[model samples]
Target: MTGADDRGIEHGLPADGPSPSALARERRENAADVLASTLETRDATAFVHAGRGREPSIRYCCESMPHGRTAVAYDGTTDEWLVRSADASDGHPAADLAATLADRGPEGTILTPPHVPHDAALYLENAGFEVASTEAIARARATKTTGECDRIAVAQRAASAGIRRAASVLADAAIVDGRLAVEDGNGDTVPLTPARLRIAIDEAIVGAGAFPAGNTAVNPETVSHPDTDADREALRPDESIVLAATPRGPSGYYGGLVRTLVVDSDGGRERRVHVAVTQSFRSARSLLTAGSASVHTVAADLEAEVRSFGLDDSDEVEATVSGVGLESCEGPIDGSDEIEPGAVVRLDVAARVDETSRLRIADVVVVTDEGERPDRLAAPAHSLSPAALLER
Candidate 1:
């Protein structure tokens, strides 16, 4: 089967008029508009949740029609969802939509998200239309469709594979000059830097039929827990290394996973932190019951679990309960939003054991109906010992 990239170039389109990247972006925008327009037509309610400034909405309409839908053009100025109507002339889209609306007569009020543009809101108000803040769009997005959930699961599986590959490399790596070194394909030992591990992670995700969509961090010095970059830092023996991967599936859905491993450790503060994080992750997962709990409740419960581990609020511990879908961080389910059955959420926790040691773990879970437990997509064993991961 031809891959997405291969199909992009199969058309043999001219490269001068618009770069491939630009054309892809335009296609996405057009698709998003179409989605918004379709929804508006069905409900007669226009939603505004554009990107920055005068930019378009990134959620209500998506670039890819993985949900099997057509694309259209969205106009924020008139708070209109415009599509290529059968009677549309070869003129401005905004004008065409206005004419169409006039012919059909106004039906419902225009709804705007929290971050709608001021001018657009003003236009709707002056046109004698009531504009209200409705989280319906965001709430609808949080409840993933069956196809969306499947795509997320695929990405999560890919992310887990990538992290597992990194662990394999770490388990067999030789501590050379306080840095991890592994034998290359030609049987020559080479120092394994953050960059090299990152490449390995990306390759693993691709091998699993997905793309590395988010940040891939391989931190040798787990204590400092510095942001993963291209730095060629040495890997010390008996130290913890944090590996976090977020991969995107072919359907434009994302999944995330994070794990910490120690090489030949004597089971000290790092190990303690790992145990605490694992317990906290389990605790958070238990709270993802449909129609009963919200992410706000989960976040509070997770923090309490962390404190019960003898870590203070001031400790360098971070725990977040966020919804994950097309975007790595989607609509966070606060106190107002319930944990719906189809919601896909990520519980991420990171803590600094001491000045130079840290541990982190994350997992993606799908909320299910009553009598059914939440489904965990990434199933790698969360172990602190490198040998345990290697054995798998």
Candidate 2:
């Protein structure tokens, strides 16, 4: 497979695009447009309780918002958007929403997300407004706008950077005691452990101006607990170190990348699985172009191919596929198994190669209107070879 050096790392996003506030308004209006379509009457109001103890649907409606803000948008009217704190002194954000609709704004039925605050639900019901929960916002959020796409791209780049940093670290390390280690300034060696590697990858994500989601994992993974030190084993030569990173961009979006890195090849089961997973990645990505049908079929075929290569763990151990966006998993792709334009899907081919080592190659990609190629946002080295991550 072609490496990052030959293909070149994806550069930074365009600097002089729309400001974050402008981007938020665009998302709000876009969400409102979807909300409008669901309402039976023209005067109905949809109140989305987002962030701060609520469903994080806030991310779909706006790029950034004050903590505890509730969204009240009118049916078919993008002109009026209310994002206010759910003041405790006043009624809850939901109660406030009901009051606002009755006293001043639209005068009809009310719509909210399926997971609404109990207080908010009660208040809306008591206000004599016909209230109901809908998946309209979630469905709307699955389709990314131009601004949303740009924000997610930045995140994807950060995720790629995290993986590259790990692979590069392995490439640069010197083998000591049959395990990879790097010499400290004091000449002591800091052996590569899962926790140590996780820190390295997280630092790279932060350096790229993104926040690590605290799920940076190293398989055959290094884990530490105050109660025990059982999982502090060092990575030995020729063993696979699967790096799975999720980094949150500055704009509250997330990017995902999962790749397996090995210090040296023993030509074992792990290596064979890596090749199969890489090919499966290519085949699955090719089928995800815009307007393509059969996401379920594609997912089934991809999983079947990976399983045929002799790796099997249930869904709890490996997510064969998921949608990547504001909150890691949301989608028409995952929900309905439909290929949606502007949707970012994580085609994760993960399975346990052996008890100690697992093989995974997951990439987050954007489904575009283009028929041939879906955009690989900030993708890193597809090759399992550590040298592939280094720049020429």
Predicted structure with the largest TM-score when compared to the true one = 2
> Which number leads on lDDT?
2
Q: Give the per-residue lDDT of model 2 (tens digit) for 1-392.
A: 11111111112333422567677677777777777677644345555454452344764554445446464444344446655466642645656656666666555567777776677777767877777777787777877778778877877887888888888788888888898887656988887777677778888887787778665777734343411253356777687777888876666677888888787877777677777777777777777753654557667767766766666555213435666766777675553467667777778876666666677788877777757677778887777788975652
Give residue 33's error in model 2 in angstroms. 2.0
CA lDDT scores, all candidates in order: 0.65, 0.67
Q: Assess every candidate by TM-score.
A: 0.76, 0.85
lDDT of candidate model 1 versus the reference: 0.65
Q: Which ranges in model 2 have alpha carbons more than 4 Å from their true place?
A: 1-17, 41-55, 62-64, 69-71, 77-79, 87-89, 105-107, 220-231, 293-295, 308-319, 333-335
Global local distance difference test of model 2: 0.67
* Off by more than 4 A, model 1: 1-95, 116-128, 220-230, 333-336, 390-392
lDDT digits (tens) for residues 1-392 of candidate 1: 21342222213422222343443344444444544665465453554443221122342353322111112334433543444322334543323433444455554565666665565456455555566665545666776666567667878888988988888888888988777798999999988776677778888987887777546777644323433443566566676778888876664567899888877788767767777888887777666642447777887777778768888767888788888876778865565566778788888888887777677888888888864778888658898766697566
lDDT of 2 at 250: 61
